[model samples]
Target: MKTFFQELKNRRVYRVAITYVIAGSATVQVVGTVLPIFHAPDWVQQVFVALVAFGFPVALVLAWCFDLEDGAIKMTCGDGRAVVTSRRVWILAGVGLLVAGSALTGYWLWHPWKRLSDAASMSSDTLSAPPVIEKSIAVLPFENLSDDKQNAYFADGVQDEILTDLAKVADLKVISRTSVMQYKTSAQRNLREIAKALGVAHILEGTVQRAGGRIRVSAQLIDARTDMHLWAERYDRDLADVFGIESELAQQIVSQLKSKLSAREKAAIEQKPTADLAAHDLYIRAKTLIASSALSTPQAESLLEAVHLLNQAVERDPAFARAYYQLAEAHDLLYLQGIDHTPARLAMADGAIQSLARLRPNSGEAHLAFAKHFYWCYHDYDRAREELTLAQKSLPNDPLPFQLAGYIDRRQGRWPESIKNLERAIELDPQNSAFLEQIARSYECLRRYVDAERALDRAIALVPKDAAMRARRAEIELHWHADARPLMSTIQAIIAKDSREGKNIAELWLYGLLCERDFDGALRALAALPIDGCHQETILFPRVWCGGIVARMRGDTASARAAFTSARNELAKLVREQPAYAEALCALGMADAALGHKEDAIREGRRAAELLPVAKDAIVGPLLVQNLALIYAWTGEKDLALEQLSIAAKLPGYLSYGQLRLHPYWDPLRGDPRFEKVVASLAPK
Candidate 1:
């Protein structure tokens, strides 16, 4: 036994295990993060936990059994005497097994408290939100210093360029543009909340200012964990040196993150874009046109011109992946909007984006283009999500993916969720006129009129001469009060303003206002908008809605019935196909109520409400409650009606706000004191 112990202690494996245990334990303690444990099964986690939990006990047992400090193995018999004592070697061998096992467990349990706490704080839904990311960042809105709002696009271009440059560092995680922009004007979120939402540890924030023939940029890298300002600086240069500014900013971030930059990464930072000043400006301006919420034909055409100049950019420098990516983006935008010949444009754009992607595998734009190509044209939601993830990594500050996420949610009737994503997109590009428009639209859809008004006010201020913003504001106000006068006057001003400038967005504005209530402005818009040659069976629904709204206004039930009959079957089919089609269900319910189909109204209203649980101020949420109340009233179930009305009265600016305004549908219970008491309770204090 003494000889066996001596040999075991002398073995090289004994020394190796001790070294590994010490080094591995220190690594586990110092470098541990959630990264190592993700996507691992519960049983694996338990095995790791068991290893860590048993480390100290095992070490003690090994020490007792080996007598390692004494350089011998002591074996005790049943009589409690040391029956056999071995030499140094065997004792050290047992110590080695104990230490190795202890280190493995320690590594598993590193930062256990923090890991568990972090996991506990997140909701699964938010964790699983679309455009998943490993790293996240927030791009605050660019500051506007230029006198002309038109120059706003230059700031956006600068920001986009920097995002593109940073994407070259493939190992670093990046948040997509859409999520960070939502915080531009947010009064609620802190840095931690922002980081958690974007799922990133670091953040890159910056500001841009435009001056005559020159630009100034200020940028910072933030350590999200500490909420510390890790680095910050300002750059003032001639407009021609914009590329320099972008590269410098990226290099600065890499330095701050202490990232190891490869030769390819270093080369990517210094690549030059177009030297033609006119072409760059044109491209920036073109991006502005497409950025607007309402798709404008003239803007699209202008963007095409910009794309032509961007071609000139690549002509000057064949190595410009950024230019190529933008060109691909422009073509896809045209194709999606039904402007450019889709097949040719899509094929060319896809090929260009793919080429650019190969050159810069970390490019957000490249991944974004491919994701969009599959998402819009191919309807491959899963592939789209994967591409969006990679795109987010490449360019973490652009809002397009967030905007896409929001748009998808809205179409699915997840209005609250959609609004959250859209708002983030606006934060990324606060000065962007397009972002403002989408936010306002989202607010309006969710029936948050105050929020819509605030967004619209900002947009109109940015583009005071533009008629669309003003029209949208007026339309929102009209719905809030259920009155059309304010909307009518705003459109006249819009038409007058457009006539002087030849910008025809006022007609588009009118088309939208007509759709809002269908009753208020459709006839005037129908008289003005283009409808001469196009023939699609889908056209009948808008026409029917227009008729319904008109009849509803005048209390002409029969006319409303006839008009609705033309669209009812189609609408019913639509609701069946997409259960989350809140708009269709809400409209159908309202039409049914007006036509005295109580059962149909109740059913559709209930379905819409369920589908839109998180949507605040939604007409459907309140409308469902209101209709349920009315149904109870008509059926002599006044108690039930009162209950539904009570539920409705809880909504912002709707329930108690309109309690006194009597509508005939609730007349059956008007004489009852119970109804009056319910109404009184609902009215705002």
Candidate 2:
């Protein structure tokens, strides 16, 4: 051992080892800092470190056998012995080089990252290529070939039925009906572009004709990538055999795509939704109305008509589980949108859910109905999620389950999860503006104003003239930079385009005017509203309340008191009818505070907070708390007001920098150090 140590020192092997270690360490440190900037894969750094390590032994072997003399290579003459150039020494040097080379080659061949990259490249042509989804399709709306134009709904029904059947197969990625309906009237029939937009590889187009108790259906499936026909069929069957033809067509598409169909999926596809054709027609009509309506007065009327049709359909065939599911959804929407937020509306939804459960308890539609019921009516998020899990397993291609999960996540204060689920829904329903709107709301709650605006921009692109989305996009400026001019300009543009559109966004226009401290404009906007009132989500504020707010802001004490008195009277009736209505109660509490009814104001505000706490609903619950803080400020309880305001500032809600800086609602808390601290906390960081 002593001779080996002396030999290593004489050959300067220790010097080479030390230099290599220092250089390798510096190289690793530099590479570690530099590689991430270029977005290199993690394994690149690992492989680099391994290569440097392999060179260390080879460096020491070369140092032992050779020397650099007068800047030239020479054999090492250890202990003055004649330049030890032996066969064993050369063999050892070669072995060291061979070992290092073998290590480098083995790592390149056997590393997990290498295998992963190779497999990925084999699976796809390019590194950045999207995975090729083989069994994916979109079913376009069937053309109405009937002599009677009203039979378009019948054609739509047949297409929807076939699409629904295809959706049941777990092996296929079927585009949702909402996405495919856009191509119903597409004259050019650009199959490739349509399929790309829908994220599918195959397209199915068909036509349905009904003539004198007989139906003729023609369907053709084409590979969108190649624009080549893969399958085509024409069926002339009696009206009674329409369901059979739809089932057969779905089976043929599955077979052509070579998708694995479990026995359960096959049985589900074969089962008929309804035995009565008349009832089925009514159900289809109801579904169409629900799909086409928005959240406006027209939407309320449309939903009501749908409910009537669904009721008639169920009456015709009590076992129509699909009709019952649609009925439940329509009723839930009516109640949720505040068109008829009465208990009777919720009870109607409950009745439909009960009937659906009795007929098909384990069906995806039934689970979805129950999930909506729990979410909208009870605010029971946990139960809704439990139902959603089951619905997702059965309805893998449907976007509703993921959309509802996003809603539940938002209510639970899981903003990241909410955004993720909403994005997943967009993947399944790329054209759904509702999903974009919801994701925008989630981003807004998290104070990601830029992301929120981008989401709203996408929604506005999908629906160009949507005043609501445009208004929302403009509102992000106020939250981000405490500027309201952009929102005011957008509202003016919308109102200028059409007075009806202005009426639709009347509440938003008033809000913008108030933010700008244009009391006269606010009052004028309020006066132009319908005599009943303007709605803010679930709350219907009376015009008197709006006038009272303007009067208070303008310091017209007598007018403010009188307006509040009348507004209080009207809101009292509303609170009496719907005692559990949190938004209406909050509005009434503000009215009471404006009128100096301090005790009543505080009581109503506390009741509203108790009805919807932040734990139960993170989105609206903080707004209720903020309203209570306002009540405290109005009642001369500055300490309590500051405390509640501080709490609201830290929670997720609609409180924005513009509102805190400019709105008169927080006037009483002005000049207080604690209130200023709370406002500064909410300012964009």
Q: Give the Cα-based TM-score of candidate 2 against the true structure.
A: 0.78
lDDT (10s digit) by residue, model 1, range 1-685: 6644443354333454455457545644443344234744445545554464446444433443543337765532122433334433245446655655665556456646444444332222222333534343455455556778777667667776666566567655545443345565665547775675555667776677777888888887777778888888999999889888888888777777766677766776777656665556655654544444234534456567757766776676666666776677777766554345335676877777777877767656678877777755444556777887777654555568777777666644566777678766755444456677776666655455666677777777656766666776776644565455566677777666554332444344443454344544545554443321111111123445555545655568777678766556656765675566555675566556656677887787667667544253243345556655665565566787777777766653234323233334466788778677766654323
Error of 1 at 281 (Å): 6.6
Cα-lDDT of candidate 1: 0.59
lDDT of 2 by residue, 1-685 (tens): 4665677787787788788778877887788678766758978877797888678767877888788879999866453754444654655466556756775666556554554444333223211213449899999999999999989888999999999999988899888888788778888899998888777899999999999899999999999999999999999999999999999999999999999988988988899999898999999999988987664534677898999999999999999999999999999988886667788998999999999999998999889999999999888899999999999888888889999998999889997788678777877777777777877877778776766776787778778888878888898888778789999999889888886776566767888888899987887677665454655444566778888888877779899889889989978887899999887798899888888899999999999999988998898788889889999999999999999998988887788777898777888999999988888888875
Candidate 2 regions exceeding 4 Å error are 1-132, 527-544, 551-563, 577-580
lDDT of 1 at 222: 76
CA lDDT, every model vs. true structure: 0.59, 0.83
Residue 204 Cα positional deviation in candidate 1, in Å, after optimal superposition: 14
